[model samples]
Target: MAIIPFNKPYLTGKETAYICQAVESGKISGNGGFTKKCQAFFEKRYGFKKCLLTTSCTDALEMAAILCNIQPGDEVIVPSYTFVSSALAFIRQGAKIVFADSYFDNPNIDADKIEQLITSKTKVIVPVHYAGVACNMDKIMEIAGKYGLFVVEDAAQAIDSYYKERPLGSIGHFAAFSFHETKNVISGEGGMLVINDEQFINRAEIIWEKGTNRAEFFRGEVNKYGWVDTGSSFLPSEIVAAFLYAQLENLDEIQKKRKEIWNYYKCLISNTIENYQLPTIPYFATNNAHMFYLICPDLSFRTKLLQKFKDNEVLAVFHYLSLHKSSYYKDKHDGRELPNADKYSDCLVRLPLYYELSDKQVEYIVSLLNY
Candidate 1:
């Protein structure tokens, strides 16, 4: 049997053609024609106030941090179970990261428990929509409103997913998305920052253009552009944008196939898995089939299960480690036990998921789990 890798990047067949077109356009730098197309697509389709492409999701998050004007001693609430970029961005701004726990049933931040962690120093609440499933945004937003805190949605894995009919990235004052090869959409490495608040739109462009008024100069709104604020080279090259635009053109087709694979895996394993938990999609969230992961009962069991998959010539993998307990942040963490985050760090396993994964492959992977 052929080994099934954990993830395969999907190609929509127009990537090369688009790349050639971008080359022919004579400009491959950031914020070119292709970049604008990709940005406009998100803004028009999702009702986002503004969108800016970035070199990576990490860049987008960093831009958001700068826009928030995070200062030393400011507090930013982040889930302990998510990718490091989610917290690292705020930490870079000298904000004290207040790590929160995940829900018992889902690996998303527990919105109900967030208020207890809030303080006068709290400046932003970042809610990462894990596995494209929506967090309890309604409750999270309510808490932020009551406390006068900014909300930034870490929607890196949540394109095309929604909360109560509103798009995932649209709910927060700022949002970040990824188009890494492993994501449903493929750009090899890319991301976008969505500015939902009008106040941040103009400044976001300036920040995205490396702290200058270059964007305004290009638009004839300014005579000349110069260094005006704190920023970095966050935008991506036109080649990345072109590849992403091709993927966006076939978004519906890609989503339909991926969802079929997701449903098939769930149907195959849900009834048979006695000691493990499957992903849970809240009623308010629409599944974009970004990933399909399993939660084993404990570290030992998960380790054994991973060995089983490897023995059967199938590759499976675990997800993020608890950020609060990481080597860099363990001492800084307030020593609050994030049980749910720890549980997920040890137990969660992601199987193969992509547009190219076929029914036979899904069944074969499930067979290993059954044994």
Candidate 2:
């Protein structure tokens, strides 16, 4: 039997060529020609008001935190089931993290419960679009509007996915996207910050350039650049941008193949598993097939299933131990019992669903699950 890893990064055959081009252009540092191309590609394709590539989605989230001007004592509401970056970004800016629970049917933040969590100190609402599935954005945005709060969408797994007719990253005041190897798009590691509010655009560029006005200086809009604000080295190098542009060029084809693989797994397991729940895309959301996960009835069953996969030389994995219950944050939590978040944290198991995973491999993995 062959060992099947949980994820294998895909390439479009143009990554090396683009990297060579970027190298020959003589500017390999952050924010060069290739970086502009990648930024322009997203801005044009997604209708994002402004897009800036970052070293990682975490960096993008951090940038959003700065743009929101999160201050000490300010509170940010985040779903407990999400990756730590969603909360850590604001937490770094001295914001209090108020973890919310997931909806019982899905791993998205319970939008209905958001209002009650809002206090006078609430500064922002961070929504993580798990597995590229959109949360109830309309409700989230409405809640944000009602309280004059900002929204930073943690769209790490939501590239090319949509909520209703709006693009996932375009709905929020600021959004962060990932190009990590495990995501639908791969650039080894990369990310982007989408600025939808025009008020933040000028400052965002300065922030991307390590708190300097160098971007304007480069464009001849200024004679010289100087440090104008507090920021850091957040932009990705041209090499990273070049690789991401290669992936962007083939986004449609990649999405199509990934969706096919995702559907095959769903079809195979829909009726075979007695006590497992598969991923669901609400009517208002479009699937980008970033991952295919199962919710086992309990942690013990999930553990057995994972061991079974390992015994068969296949790799399956779990995701996101609830951050509210994490050793670092548990004591800080306000004693709210987030049952649904903990439930998903213990029961969710992600199967192999990469661009290169073949139909035969999918069948074999499903066979192991059925056994």
Candidate 3:
């Protein structure tokens, strides 16, 4: 039996040609022509104030942390059911992470529970848009406004997703997006940091250029550039940008095909299976079809179901093991039992989803769900 992998990176066929063009043009470094084109695509399409390409989403989050100026003892509220980068970015800046619980019915942070978690030490609220579904941004933004807390959206899986007609990355004060191979869009490993607040725009450029003002000097806005801020080598090379631009050009077609695969999984699984909870898209959110996942009835059921997948030579997986309970953070946690976050940590199973998935493979995978 041929095994079905969890994810396969899709290529637009123009990636190599673009890379060749970038190399022939003689500037294949970060923030070059291809980078600008990629950045402009996001800015124009999503209405983001500014976009800076980074080597990875984790780097983007780190840049957001630098811009936030987090200090020791400062608290940043983050959902327990997200990637480590969401919390690690702030932790690296010496901010204590205050892990929040997810909604009982969904993987997104519980917006209603967030206000109660806020304290004088709270500096930011990091919302992770899990599986490309929008979090409750309206409520979240309202709470942030009331508390004067910054919101850095971890929109790693939320490319092209929207909340109430507003794009996900455009809602937060700062947002980070991923272009990992497994994502809807791919450059093998790439990401972007979005600056929505004008105050951080200048500082962001400096931070992006390794704490220097080189970008300004290049633009002739300054006579000379030197070390002026704090940053790291966060930008991806032009080769990655070139590959990403090719992917961006075909984003609509890619999204259309992925959404078709997502719908196929939903329709088949919903009809053939019972008791399992299908993915729920809130009325205010638009699905970007990043990955299709289902919540099994319980941890035991999920464990056994995964074994079944292995036995059948199909790849199935779980996501986010609740950072609050991890060994590194368990002792550091505030001892609050986040049942909902833990529930998702143990129960959510992502099925294979990619642009090139065929109807025959879909039927085979769906048939396995009958177990």
Candidate 4:
């Protein structure tokens, strides 16, 4: 028996060639030719007001936390079912995290419950698009407008995905995207921050360049660059940007193949599986086929399901443990029971659905589930 791994990053065959060209061009530093090209590609394609390439999605979230002006004792609402970066970014800014629950039917933040979480100290809502599915952005935006709160979309899994006709990253005031090897697109480890509000664009660039007007100075808008605010080194080298650009150039082909894999998995599983809930892509969201996941009936069932994979020489995986219940945050939580989030934490299982996963493998996995 051969093992089918959970994930395998697909390369476009141009990554090293672009990296070599970038190396030969004599600028391997950040914000050079390749960086600009990647940024321009996103802005033009997504209609983002401004785009900045960052070292990772975590860095992009950190930049969003800064742009939101989070302060000590401020509050940020984040879904408990999300990765820690969604909450940790605001927490680093000295903001208190108010963990929200996921919807009973899906892993998105329960939008209807968002208002109850808002308070005088509330400053931002960090919505993570779990598995690349959109949260209810319309409701979220309405709540934000009513309370004068900022929205920083954690679009790490949502590259090339959409909310209605609008791109996922463009709907929020600020959005962060991941280009981790595990994602549909691969640059080893890279990300982007999108600013939809015009007012924050200048400050965003300053923040991206380590709190200096260096970007302006270099563009001839200023005579000298000086440190004027707080920031850190968030830029990735041109080598990373070059690799990312190569991936970006093949976005359509990559997406098409990924979607094909995802569809095949869904078709096979629907015919064979009877006890698990498949991933849900809402009517308002476009699936990017970032990953395919299942919700077992209970934790015991999920444990058995994972063991079955091991017995069959396959590797499926569980997703996030609810941040509210994690060792670090359990005591800090406000004590409201987030049943749905905890349920997902205990029972969600993600199967292999990468660009390279084959139809035969999908059939085998589904057959195993049926057995």
Q: What is the total number of backbone clashes in candidate 1?
A: 0
lDDT of 2 by residue, 161-228 (tens): 99998899999999999999999988888899999999999899998888999989998999999999
Candidate 3, 61-103: lDDT as tens digits: 9999999999999999999999999999999999999999998
Off by over 4 Å in 2: none
Off by more than 4 A, model 3? none
Give me the runs in candidate 4 sitting further than 4 Å from their true place: none
Candidate 3 Cα lDDT to native = 0.94
User: How many residue pairs clash (N, CA or C atoms closer than 3 angstroms) in each of the candidate models, in the order given?
Assistant: 0, 0, 0, 0
Tens digit per residue, CA lDDT, model 4, 1-371: 47999998888899999999999999999999999999999999989999999999999999999999999999999999999999998889999999999999899999999999999999999899999999999999999999999999999999999998899999889999999999988789999999999999999999999999999999999999999988889999999999999999999999999999899888887876789999988899999999899999999999998999999989999999999988988998999999999999998999987877888888888887864
User: Could you list the CA RMSD of all candidates, in the order they appear?
Assistant: 0.8, 0.8, 0.8, 0.8
TM-score for each prediction? Answer: 0.99, 0.99, 0.99, 0.99
Error of 2 at 105 (Å): 0.9
Model 2 residue 4 lDDT score: 94
Model 1: residue 179 alpha-carbon error in angstroms: 0.7
